[model samples]
Target: MELRYSPFDFTVHEDPYPFYARLREEAPVYHNEKDGFWALSRHADVLAAFRDDRRFSSRNGIRIEEPFWGPQAEQFFSFVAMDPPKHTRMRGLVNKAFTPRRIAALEPRLLEIARAHLEPLLEGEEFDLIDFAAKYPTDVISELVGVPESDREQVREISFAVMHAPEEGDGQMHEGSTDAMGALIGYYAQLTAERARRPQDDLLSGLLQVSENEDRLTPEEVIGVLVLLIGAGSETTMLLLGNAWHAAWKHPAERERAFAGRIEDWIEETLRYDPVSQSSPRTTTEDVELHGVTIPAGEKVLLLSGAANRDPRAFPDPDRFDLDRDTGGHLAFGNGRHHCLGAPLARLEARLALTELAATVADYEIDEAAAKRVHTSINRGFVSLPTRVTARR
Candidate 1:
């Protein structure tokens, strides 16, 4: 069979590792003439590309879909879509608000939030893990960003609409997604203005007040950051929790280890074994030659981090979901200057949420036949995992 790969292909979404494996061995510099993008699947190649920002530009954003791609990507992706200087400045201002102190302070609140969602489900015999997965991170991020509890559900719905891509489309933003993006922008614009008028002890107000000498974030930039946070911060963690749950359920021994206080290993291994973010998009800044293939300048390229994590060169027995392996350099949160800013929060949320689950639930099972996966351009995970738990005595 001819080796072909497209991020929008549903079949690829079902199991991209095989396709990624083929690309790594047969066509490390695979090009899809139909999708009009090139890909790198080798561990070393993708890692090097991530570190070579000068060569692999982020000016076109990290997604290869329409409307979200191109120069205006900053409107949605904020500093994530920018090259250095611009990216550096924007990220600097935002970092003050995203301090380690702030994140650590949220730990107590995060536990409260997790228990609030998990306790109810524990009272029942069976429930969809997605319900808890979807709600927990939305609330955690909302609480951090100062979104009113009243509006969190609405915000979650809008974020979902924005992240969702129709399984049948050609990777274009549907009208519904367009409207959701508009609505999210409008909501954040109003929130930014309100925070400016009445500063609070929250990230939104911190962003408004953060300044570096004469430089500060514009209201528009603040709004952009919020939208980026709600989308990236919320959705990715939501899927990560779901992926962690599903991974554990599939491997009972590892699941038992996770339940026996190996929470951190479980999270790290899940991240390496089956990351929620499968790929990241970049545009070439100059012609680059690799493996005797010359990729032209300004062409769209995908660094298949999903495949890289599973490379045999990087990990022995890459297919196994063992809780004991050294998952050191996985590109789950990516690499370089563009590494995910929300990584700490994402890990904290997953650790705490899963810890709470492990403490209370002795064992769990996911209805594999009933599990439904989320369809998106760059993300991979379940949207519905029908799960049943056994309470620890």
Candidate 2:
């Protein structure tokens, strides 16, 4: 089949994996002339590109196309869009705050947050998982980043606005949402300034307290990192959680396996089987040859995480959602220096969310017709999922 991949194409959203399989098998280094980007779909190529950061640089920006008309990577995305040693320096500054121990300490608080969102649904048989997925992570990440509970609504509102930048017929970003970006950054500036002054017991305060005696990120950098964390941790985890629930509803055997004694396995398989973060975009620093094709330097290359996760060469029976298979190699979280820092927290949230969900429902029926997939090229998950639960006695 002829290959064409458009980030704005929502038709592919419903079942892109089938198309992704075709990309991996037929055109591993698929190029899109209209949008002017290359896609690396095979698992091996994606992993290699991720490891060779020197060749496939992230400095330009992560999105295949710039999100706006102006400068983005440096100002908007913080370290994610920057390469080392700048990436290294910035990550080192914030790394202390996101350590496993720090994230583990939030378990009690995260559990509290999850339960707060899930409690109301326990009483009702017919409810949507989207509400729980959307609310829990935003609150947890907000509290962790020092956004006051009162301001979380504003933070989340701005985040959703930014993530859903209006798509033109070509699937590129619309110009109108620049104000949302300003609103988000301006909000973070106020929060960071407060955290610096008061020194709250939160991550933002922790970043501020980093010794200014040595290498440290600027105030703007701190705000940039915090803003990225708020949006990345919230919506992505919501996608993971919603996808996990959707997987369980679709595959009864996997649900039974999770409830029986393999919740983590179920989550891992769901990540591989139906990951939310569908792709990671990188720009080639120089001309590079791969899979019999040489992509010129400076071109944007999309690592199809959703496609690579299901690459049959790496994953046997890639289409089947089987908890029995090993998922350690999955690129749901990209590989190497740029691997997602919030992965531990996202995984923790998924485990807690799924464990609670499995324990609460004796069985659940998903209203597939009512399920609304979020319309975006980057992530794949639901905006709404209507499910009817049979509470366990």
Candidate 3:
């Protein structure tokens, strides 16, 4: 069989690790002409690419799909799709508002949110873990961003539409997605305007007020940040919870350990073993030669972090989901200046949510046959994880 890799392929979405392994061994610099992207599969290569932002520019955005791929990618991805200077300016302002203190303060609220969602579900005989997984992070992010509770379900729905890809397609954003994106932006724009008018203690108002020597975020930039948070802040964390649950269920012994209070290790191992973010896209600033292949300048490149995380050179016995292993230096949250800003928040949410789950539920079983994976270009995780938990008395 010919070796081919496409982020858009449903088969690849089902399980990309096998293909990633082959790409690492056979073609470390694998190219998919159909998808028009070159991929780096090895850990060293992917890490180097992540750290070498000058060579592998983020200007073209991290997604290969249309509408989200070009110069206007900043509209969707915010500073994530930007090169320095612009990225520096925007990120600096954002840093002032999205502070560590703000995130730390949310810990108590996060626990409350987690228990609020998990406790009721534990009372039921059978429920979808994804229900709690999706709603918990959505509420956390909404609370941080000052979204009204009444509007959050609609926000989550629009975010789902924005992230969802057609099961069968050429891997392009559908009209529904585009429309949803518009609605999301419009919604945030209104929110930004309202915050400008009446400042609140939420992150949105923080972004509006935050300044660096008289340089503050514009209204458009604030809205862009809010929209970016929906995907990066809310959607990714939602998927992370589902992936962690599924990974533990697949490894019963490890699951027992996780249930025995190895929450941090379990979260770390799950991140490396089966990361929610499988791959991230970049564009080459200049021609780069690697492994006897010359990738031309200005081409799409995918840093296959999923494959990199499992590379044996970096992690011994990488396939096994052992909670005891040291999971440091994983590319799960990426590396370099473009590393995920919301990583701390994501980890905190996972820790609090899973810890609460472990406290309330003695055991749980996932209905593997009934579990459904979300169809998306970049993310990989369950959208419907039917589960039955044995509640702790």
Q: Please give each candidate's TM-score.
A: 0.98, 0.95, 0.98
Which is the better candidate, 2 or 3, if ranked by lDDT? 3
Highest TM-score against the true fold, candidate: 1
**Model 3 backbone overlap count:** 0
Cα lDDT of model 1 by residue, 1-393, tens digit: 988788988888788889988998999999999989999999999999999999999999976678889999999899999999999999999998899999999999999999999898899889998889888988898899999989988988888788763545487767888789999999989888899999999999999999999999999999989888877888899899998998898899999999999999999999999999999999999999999999999999999899999999999999999999999989999999999999999999999999999998988878889988887778999888998888889
Whole-model lDDT for model 3 versus the true structure? 0.89
Rank ordering of all candidates by lDDT, starting from the highest: 1, 3, 2
Clashes of each: 0, 0, 0
lDDT tens digits, residue span 1-393, model 2: 466667668778888977897888888899888777889999998999899999998887655444631246767678888889988888888887667887898899888888888989889889989888888888888878878888988887787777665666465666645678788899889988887778878888888777536766677988988778766788899888889888987898878888876889988998999998889888888999987899998888889999999988999989998988989999998999999999999999888888888788888889999998876667889888999989989
Error of 2 at 186 (Å): 1.5
Candidate number that wins on lDDT, 1 or 3: 1
Per-candidate local distance difference test: 0.91, 0.83, 0.89
Worst 10 residues of 3 by lDDT: 163-172
Candidate 1 regions off by >4 Å? 165-167
Error of 2 at 283 (Å): 0.8
Report residue 41 deviation for candidate 3 (angstroms): 0.3
